[model samples]
Target: MTGTLEIRGLGRNFGGLKALEDISVTLAPGEILGVIGPNGAGKTTLFNTISGVFRPSAGTVSLDGRIISRMRPDQIARLGVGRTFQSTTVFPETTVRETLERARSFLTAHSPMAWLGSFGQRAAGHSVDRVLKRIGLDGMADSEAISLAYGFQKILGIGMALVQRPRLLLMDEPAAGLNSSEKIEVTNLIRGIRDEYGIGILLVEHDMKMVMGLCDRVQVISYGRHVAIGTPEEVRTNSDVIDAYLGKDHELA
Candidate 1:
């Protein structure tokens, strides 16, 4: 089944600080939804909440019509959800293939005795090969993950999530540290994931060009509130969105 994510009235409170409140949004299968706001706008909190890294003080997160808000992170991950951090965090000392194989263990886990008896999982190994190919690192499987160029390292982060074959991918600033051309590569990679695999994507990005060009719709937040949502053009002209990004002193031009 195509994975659809629904967040309803999501709220998170750290003591008196409300990082997110009453934030609601839905991601349909194969849709790329961009979430953008200034720093501290709670974009990371939202992603964390959805990924089960943090439990919401209120509201619920659902995937494929099942409640996942209360599930453990590994449980949520096993339920066809994947996440890439804002930073390109990978196994610095591990080869690309080994990294993926280890990540794949999250989904294809076995008893330790069984693992000892059969060290190789043919299917999981094949899956890692497919992910390496998809992320354009098939030839570099034996290279240390950290040895790749920075952009390729970011791509490896995507591969780490993709190795699980998730139906929904939560990507936090996939283009954060890339040059213009590298940004284009990430844009294409995101679009290709949606088009080719039909994975729903929830993207948090500060790069307006990538978000505007890649997302089917955009959601804007301010001070933990979901302020605006619509097509990129619609959000581009929205006054609240303008204020959120540019401040009230300036107007959208």
Candidate 2:
């Protein structure tokens, strides 16, 4: 279900200040687009704008050419866009299976308590089992959410989103706070999602190594503006990107 995503003339303002400015980018079906910027460079703001947390001051966002920029977050989510927050979003008290099943229930026809009512435990167990297998969490299905490692918890967030079978996933720092091995696990997981489920990804991350290693293309932002957009090699060699990250590391470029 992955399809193209287009952002045109996207801008967001906070009273006197502009958080994002005329940002435009496109992500093709089944492709991973990396977004990188220094702090306060409007990276997360752009994610918020696309994800509908903030209505853009101007412009349009489209998935498969369908406008969704100003839609409600839930509405956007239902239309095949799923997102994982920067911080862990799971409820610590819930079991791994319960977490994803609850998200699926809310996203579709069922309610959280519906599992307890008409469907009974049998149906609920099936639903939870399906999502756990989908995200490689089947082994931890019975584990408490609070008991899992932070990395798995992050994957569980993704599992919750996957239960909705979203077409485009906006991941905020998917590798943040992870050790090298965990980061590798996340990178592979992202690729597996794209390869197996046909989901396109828009990754907002600070791990330049991960971004450069995993992305099909990249967009760089500095001061609320896109300074470069291209292949990993092209962006890595760009003078502006070198200046933004490298400073005198431009010598390496």
Candidate 3:
């Protein structure tokens, strides 16, 4: 079944500092939701809470109607949640195929032994082929990951996630370091994943053009508070959103 993802009253603290406080949001099947805010506005903290990298000091996280807040990172991942980091996390020494092959171990099994057997690599080979085709990297399967262009490496990150066949993908700035044209290409590929693969996407981006063009809904946070949530047209005109991004130039709206 296509799953539902929900975050309710999620909170996180770093001793004296509260990184995220009382945050809540939901994502439906095949929806692309964008989260945007200024630096230290708690964007990544929210993602960390959802991905089980940090347990909330309070509140719950659910997927497909099941409470998963207490699950470990791997457990949460196995439940069909995939996440990409703000910085690329590829193995610089491995080939493109090998990188995906490593991801397959987690995607295909629930036990560590399953990852140790010969079948892991065999199954990984098949999964890698499928993801390569999906991400348009089939021809470069044997190329060293360190040797690919920066944009292609980013695409490889997406391809690695695709190999897992996750129901929900948490993407943090997929277009962070690309040129204008490259950003457009990445945007189209992300849209394809939602439309063609039926995966729900939670996109955290600073690029307004990409967010405005690609997201079905945009959620804006300021000072760790959700200041606005609406369609691109609606948020574009929101005063709080304006002040956060454009300050006095907000009158341009």
Candidate 4:
């Protein structure tokens, strides 16, 4: 069942550098929340903390009221949280089926061969097929994931996360490095995830159009702190947000 992801007063430090300080947001089940900010705004740090890649220096992260700040990444994933990174690289010669199989296998405590002995293996196979079809990759299941086009490779990353059947999905830049058509495809897919599967989504993306149009609510952060949180319209017009994130060109110096 879907549950809330609560990050209260979340803080992270790199020795003396504060990456995130007092960052907070409550992502209710089935809601899509956007975390957008300019360069060096701690967006990645917050995601790393929530996904258990980094432990918070202070505050708490909870799912269904259970504290999860100190949990391992694999452990957190099994608790109905799945994440896709900013980039994806499939193993050479590995088919799409194999890629997803590995991701799903991570949630189970059994070896893949051992898992096949259980009655659940049939169900697992079905899940793999279902995900491939859902992501529009069914026809290419036997094809190498590395052989797919760049857009499909990115979508495959999302499918890898989906086979886990997560209640909440952490997506990093879902629309990054895509052509216009691919961008539209990803936008629809993200919406379908929320409306069809009822999964809460937390995404960090630089694509303002996609984020502003798709998210139920938007959260803006800067310099390790949350600057604003509100509906799309509210966030678009917020002076602080415009000045802090949207107004600034984050190109490398």
- The lDDT for every candidate, in the order shown, is 0.86, 0.83, 0.84, 0.87
Compared to the true structure, candidate 1 yields what TM-score?
0.91
- For 105-169, candidate 4 gives per-residue lDDT tens digits of 77775534454566667778999998898889899999888889999999999998999888899
TM-score, prediction 4: 0.93
Cα lDDT of candidate 4 equals 0.87
lDDT of 1: 0.86
Model 3 per-residue lDDT tens digits across residues 50-159: 99999999889999889989999888988889986444545768998888877666556666557577766666677778788878888998989889898888998898
State the displacement of the C-alpha of residue 153, model 4, in Å, after optimal TM-score superposition. Answer: 0.3
- Give the lDDT of residue 222 in candidate 2: 88
Best by TM-score: 4
Off by over 4 Å in 1: 85-89, 110-120, 247-253
Worst 10 residues of 3 by lDDT: 244-253
TM-score of each: 0.91, 0.89, 0.90, 0.93
In model 3, how large is the Cα lDDT of residue 148?
A: 89
Q: Per-residue lDDT for 42-139 in model 2, tens only?
A: 99999999989999999999988889997998888888888874556457688887777777766665434454665655665675677677668899
- Backbone collision tally, model 2: 0
Clash totals in order: 0, 0, 0, 0
TM-score order of candidates, top first: 4, 1, 3, 2
Residue 178 error, candidate 2, Å: 0.7
Better of 1 and 3 by lDDT: 1
